[model samples]
Target: MPLKTVNVGLIQQACGADRNTNLAESINGIRELAEHGAELIVLPELHAHSYFCQLEDPTSFNLAEPIPGPTTDALGAIARELGVVIVASVFERRAAGLYHNTAVVLERDGHIAGTYRKMHIPDHPGYYEKYHFTPGDLGFTPIDTSVGRLGVLASWDQWFPEAARLMALAGADLLLYPTAIGWNPDDEEEERQRQWEAWIIAQRAHAIANGIPVVVCNRVGSEDDPSGQTPGISFWGTSFIVGPQGEWLGTASAEEPATLVAEVDLSRSEEVRQAWPYLRDRRIDAYAGLLKRYLDR
Candidate 1:
């Protein structure tokens, strides 16, 4: 195959309580990258509003909107005008009393390419997602676009190797993660460092294991816990793009908002996979143990 290079952009920024301001910032970031010749752009998870999952309030459900609702309409227009494919995350109100953390992909022509509902929902202190999102029913499927096939996943999904492998098996050219992760304000500095390093290492491992490039866009800055029980979360923004061999292509700032554009040679995945041959060596016939909750003797 011929070398197919694509300019991919990552938008990492902080979100405030104001919806319009957040949306505008994301749009501006997209436009900036588009002007710099990026054909594919990705934004941080839930760029339309603050990380409301910090504390689960029933009123937070109000933030959820339909797939073709206002957010898509707005992003679609920019995609059309800029002629860029966009991967954006949304708080999806699938139905009355049913919602999901979803990722929406817009083609360069401003049409809804495809959508992925988040399969993994994290439930823990400082990241109470189960209270707001229903686990995705839409399995691991990649969205096809002009640039290439995109394997889109949300925040928590990045931690699971199964998710990445499934997408790769389905023929994804590149893996994209729109994330909103941060540190609990009370943790020690060493603990925070370990957490951040683990996050980076895990994602890089996915690229090495699957022989596909990986892109991650994460939110930056601090968001206070609405209930005031805890100091709140300090979002560590280290958005990055890595090649098929798990080599860093480009990385953004850890403490500030950043816009990054990196040229990815899509054909490299084929070359790397041919050399690594990890997929060819899979023991699919003996992996029934993966389906069980635990293997009790």
Candidate 2:
């Protein structure tokens, strides 16, 4: 079980073309939040560089680096200096030709707690991640840390309840999503609104189902697509934290760089589960067909 209370900070920032500049900005944001008494800091996915998934080119592969590479080294030092736990997303260069979207947890002492590679890779209109990253083989398991047990998931992973449920079953105390999703410039007002609503509701539903708090940190601002075939995506940066009962704790703006800090009562999860025991009533025996692609005859 977690302590009496855990304070989580979400860093929502705009990604620039320069990776060095972006890393410095994220470091500054983490420091600012730590000064404000944030014990656990979460950063947006791929914070070191601009969203390169908008286009598929061989040059994008250069963005991937090793797990204990320079980025983690710098972040580990920051974590140690501030005595805070940090969850940072990165594009991992596992080998000469293989890469993955990975999240690393750094303990207060600057040692790496664990790592979770993104399982669900999206290949949508603007999210061409499949070309750059291979699906994670690290199964759905929580990373035990100094702060608490963290079930860290990537952007597209938030859309699937199975991923969240598996983490909960594995004893995850809280779910953290390092995300980078945005609105297409050509999307109509109504379409954009619905998409945003679904995005927020889906994660909150995960919190409600698993009886745990959820934290999401998303990138803000728009970056142009190099191909020039279409207008770039305007990242809707409404980073937020939701409670076990699907209640909103704190939320950032949809178009600005901001740091949101909120306190969550980890013990309340037990209370909520006792009152509404969804997990206890699950029919584990009747779910063998879930492995099939479809039930069509």
Q: Note the Cα lDDT for every prediction shown.
A: 0.95, 0.94
Candidate 2 per-residue C-alpha lDDT over 135-228 given as tens digits, one digit per residue, 9 for 90 to 100: 9999998999877899999999999999999999999999999999989989999999999999999999999999999999999999888889
Off-target runs (Cα >4 Å) in candidate 1 are none
- State the local distance difference test value for candidate 2: 0.94
**Candidate 1 per-residue lDDT over residues 1-297, each given as its tens digit:** 888999999999999999999999999999999989999999999999999998979999998999999999999999999999999989999999999999999999999999999999999998899999999999999999999999999999999999999999999999999999989879999999999999999999999999999999999999999999989999999999999999999999999999999999999998999999999999999999999989999
Worst 10 residues of 2 by lDDT: 1-10
lDDT of 1: 0.95
| Candidates in order: C-alpha RMSD to true structure | 0.6, 1.1
lDDT of 1 at 104: 99
Top TM-score hit? 1
